[model samples]
Target chain A: MIETKDLRFRYSDTLPFVLEGLNVTIKRGSFVAILGHNGSGKSTFAKHLNAILLPSGGKVLVDGMDTVDEDRLYDIRQHVGMVFQNPDNQIVATLVEEDVAFGPENLGVPQKEIRVRVDEALRAVGMYDFRDRATYQLSGGQKQRVAIAGIIAMRPRCVVLDEPTAMLDPVGRREVMRAIHDMNRTLGITVVLITHHMNEAVDADRVLVIDHGKLLLDGTPREVFSQAETLYRADLAVPQPVELIYALRRDGVDIPGDVLTVDECAEALYHLLKSRTNTRG
Target chain B: MLKDISLGQYIPGTSVIHRMDPRLKIVLTLAYIVVLFMAKGPLSYGLVLLTLGLIIVLSRIGVRFVLRSVRPLLFIILFTAVLNMFHVDGDVLWSWWILKITRQGIETAIYMALRIAMLISGTFVLLNYTTSPIMLTDGIEQLLGPLKRIHVPVHELAMMMTIALRFIPTLIEETDKIMSAQKARGADFETGNVIRRAKALIPMLVPLFVSAFRRADELAVAMECRCYRGSEGRTRLRTLKLQGLDYVAIAIAAVLAAGIITLGVVLP
Candidate 1:
């Protein structure tokens, strides 16, 4: 679990604060998505989770260990893994299995144990078959999956991913999302996914909207997307289906604004049309 | 064209030579180079050649593939051989204008060329063709471990080498993309004189260097997130343990050096 108390940060004294007076708590084994546009301080917030960037004001505590404690830095990192946007830059090894083993190796895990963790991690991410393949030769999706595997190999209690699918294609995005969901659901690892894609947040247990380093909205996806006007004011957009429903509601079509998926939107429209036809009959 | 750039000439295989401990292979390669220089006459060179041939056979990497390592240096090899042919003075085998060919000069030229070629082939067969770049760096780090006591950053150097090796292909790919992008924007790279051609690459190099630095920064952060603190307390998944075959390899190398030294002493 991660808890941030009035977490505030700025790259330097000359620059303004990137994160300003934000307080949030990420629960253990829960999937949470942090949505924000570019320069919204979401990434700065994620960086503080694992102590990659210390907060200039207030504090970030991971499993009750303060991020500013120099002695517990590695311990905090090992407990909360991080995956970055660019998959190519993050992978340390040329080969697939070796890259996955990199985390455990850095932790000084025993040789036999590292191998088991590497294999298990690769299998969990569906990369076991490509374990011997070269890392660069893989497609974008496969490489991102390998990056996720590298993180999970350390057996972290929580993972904070900063726009992991930003550079990926649609298919790659789906593959990465599926892998993220699997880690959260099957392994019971807490996931804090920072993404601009509203659809990616639809499946999360909680959604936190960050606007100018402030927590603008914090609720379930349905509750957050229902307030489409506020999201637009924050320079964010709801998922496509939710956007459609929002538009229909604005036009006085009496459609629900809480729809988050295509299937749910279609079913709601179908029922509305059936009722209209029944009234005419 | 950039896709063809191979960082290390590693030919993966399950052969005993490929499976040998990389530390042993690196030490043996150094010994092989030393014995190669110690060789003087045809008998000693022939012994070295025989040993190299045995290694090539055991590595299971085809001879033609191994010879590719020497192909890039063909011009230098021939230039040295030709210089040796004319520089040495001895009994004249022939004469044409200022070029007088001596029997000793011809012998030396042939020996020199053969030595250079065999030395390259021997190393290619033993190290590059068998051990992966990661394993090679691992071997170097372990071999240089003692220097750490003298304040040498051997692990850091090896880590740098491994990271550089990992990024070569990625950087090459980026170069290709930048080249194509420049070409699309009407930039010329191939149609001018040497200076013009060199100048055209400035646009390409600038972006490549910028992206590379950015990648380095991001990679450093990623490394820290995975608990990488330095060489201290870090363990490797693949620990190099010397097998029986590795000992046999070292023994053979020792005998080869001994044979070459004996041939030098006895023949002269």
Candidate 2:
């Protein structure tokens, strides 16, 4: 489990923070999505997860080991691996297989094991074919997958992707999100997806809303979308189906349901139309 | 690795030098250097210079690139000339108080300058213009393959050299970015005293060094990830092969050197 208590971080004490008084807990093996508008302290909160940014006050722990402690730093990092926004910055190796093996190698894994892990990670991420290819030649989606494979090879219990799909195109974004969903479902690895896209967060198990450096709301995606006022107050938005349902209900349609998924919304609409047909007949 | 250092600085061309086998090119360069020292007076030096200039022209590399390569050594050239200017004791052609200009001094200065320029330009033709560093180092390693019997780490050294060459541009690019970023943070590297300027570079240098170390660490991890376990049984993807043209080229260069050496000494 990842836990943050009263996590207040500032670049310098003389200045105010982009993250303040943030208290959050992430359950193990759960897909958690953190959503907030720009300048609402979501990115700053994301950096604090892997001890990339140390908290000025309070504490952060990855599997009971405090991030504030120096000896537990690498362990914390290994446990809670981070994939940065820019795919270019995170990838250190020219070759795909080598890039995948980076984190495990840093932990001093033997060459044979590293080979196995590299191959496993590449195959897992569906980038096994591009193992020997020059990273410069890889497309943006391929590059981001390579970066994810790099993090995956480390065997982190929790993978924190900080807007990994932001730089990608529509196709690239879908490809990356599918990969993330597959990793979460198949590997059972807990994923903390920090994104600005509401639709991306729709399928997640839990949603946490941050605004002005504080936790504003936390619940399941459906439960959270049920409360429309909170998201609006936080300057955040809901998924497409939820937004459509809310708009229809606000337009005097007697839709008394919270719709998170497209299929769920369609089913709800079918029921409403059927009832209307019976009443008219 | 840094990508802009021009270490893999091969300019693709259909010139004779570019087409020559790398190993043969290495052998020819060594032989040429040896012959260059044998160059005695005006006739031999003139032949060497003319031959190099011809090759440079054929290579189609810009004069500016060659000049840029030599620019770093300008101080050394000037120093050697200045030293020879004062130190060479010979026929005193003229004297202006302590600044005496001798006939032999003038000739020695010109010869030294010409020798330095010819040596650099010729090698630059082989290295910077014609062949890439990776190929060059590979050629050197292959040529020195026999040293493996004597327990020389020729492969390892060659690998190290290639990596160093590869990272030159990467590091330069990193440094450029760091400088720009630090400048954005209002760090002034220009318009300061020597100490102040040095102090101002702390932010830039710190980040650059951090990034370099980070890259090195990451590269090491990546290499280990790829199952790289030193110079034991690695095979080359692009093995070097010598063609008939390579032998003919080397033979031609050998004969040219021989003819020049013979005519310079015996005829003189």
lDDT of each: 0.92, 0.78
Q: What is the DockQ of candidate 2?
A: 0.07
Q: DockQ of candidates 1 onward, in order? A: 0.86, 0.07
Looking at model 2 chain A, report the run of 10 residues with the lowest lDDT sum: A86-95
For candidate 1, write residues A24-130 as lDDT tens digits. Answer: 99999999999998999999999999998999999999999999999999999999999999999999988899999999999999999999999999999999999
Model 1: what TM-score for its first chain?
Answer: 0.98
TM-score for model 2? Answer: 0.60
Put down candidate 2 lDDT per residue, B137-218, tens digits, no spaces. 8798998989999999997788677566546656787688988888898878898789999988888888888877876665
* TM-score for each model: 0.97, 0.60
How does residue A128 of candidate 1 score in lDDT?
98
Which segments of model 2 are wrong by more than 4 Å? B1-268
How would you encode candidate 2's per-residue C-alpha lDDT over A12-81 as one tens digit per residue?
A: 9798976778778899999999999998888888878877778999888889988888787777777877
True contacts kept of each: 0.82, 0.01
